[model samples]
Target: MMEEKMEDRNKIKTELIVVIVEKDMSGEVIDAAKQGGADGATVMYGRGSGIHENARFFGITIEPEKEIVLILVDAAIRNAVLCSIQKKIEIDRPGMGIAFVLDVAKVIGSPHLNLMSDITD
Candidate 1:
């Protein structure tokens, strides 16, 4: 049964949707993602050092605060969620931050996986 469960898990493909946005905008992005079929997401605080992150005042460097949102979803909903995020945040604009997707080979002990299985079954 253990091997059977592992095989079932393997059959489910997953993807990670990563969105980096200004700290204040994280909530809006998460809401949009949910509208697009995402179950939920994990957010973390961070600082950006990219070209757009450079700001100086009184000759002192400033690193803008950022929020990194990580959302794991079934591969089937990846595109829908991405599109919804872009539509809400307009990430394509300069200084609006970025969003990307990564293929997840394996996911262990994630409630997101269980949710996906329930939906599929």
Candidate 2:
């Protein structure tokens, strides 16, 4: 029975939120997610677009500042992290940034295995 339960737990799906924000605000975003109970996160520099376009002054392109933060969390904490990020980053405002969730089907890492070990016992 314990073995079966562990297998089931391993099969459970998790959600990952990929957030892109202004370079300066990345720390606030990460802190918000941590307060919301995300286990871990990864951040990197990136560029993206939406309804807004780059501003131009005298025909010079004004590149918008950007940073990408990827957070992997169990499904149970998805909503909390989402709401916290939205509130902290003011994603509803223009030029703020965007965040979206994706399904993580499988995870491979010793940490993940250790996380499941207690269930197997």
> What's each prediction's TM-score?
0.86, 0.79
lDDT of each residue in 1-121, candidate 2, tens digit only: 9778767767666778999888778899899998888866788996655557577789997777688998888888899998998888788788788899998766656363233434223
Write candidate 1's Cα lDDT for 1-121 as tens digits.
8667656867888999999999899998899999999988989999999986789999999999999999999999899999999999999999999999998766666875662233332
RMSD of each: 4.5, 4.2
Model 2 ranges off by over 4 Å: 1-6, 110-121
lDDT of each: 0.86, 0.78
lDDT, candidate 2, at 71: 88
For candidate 1, report its TM-score: 0.86
**In terms of lDDT, which candidate is strongest?**
1
Task: Write down the RMSD of candidate 2 (Cα, Å).
Answer: 4.2
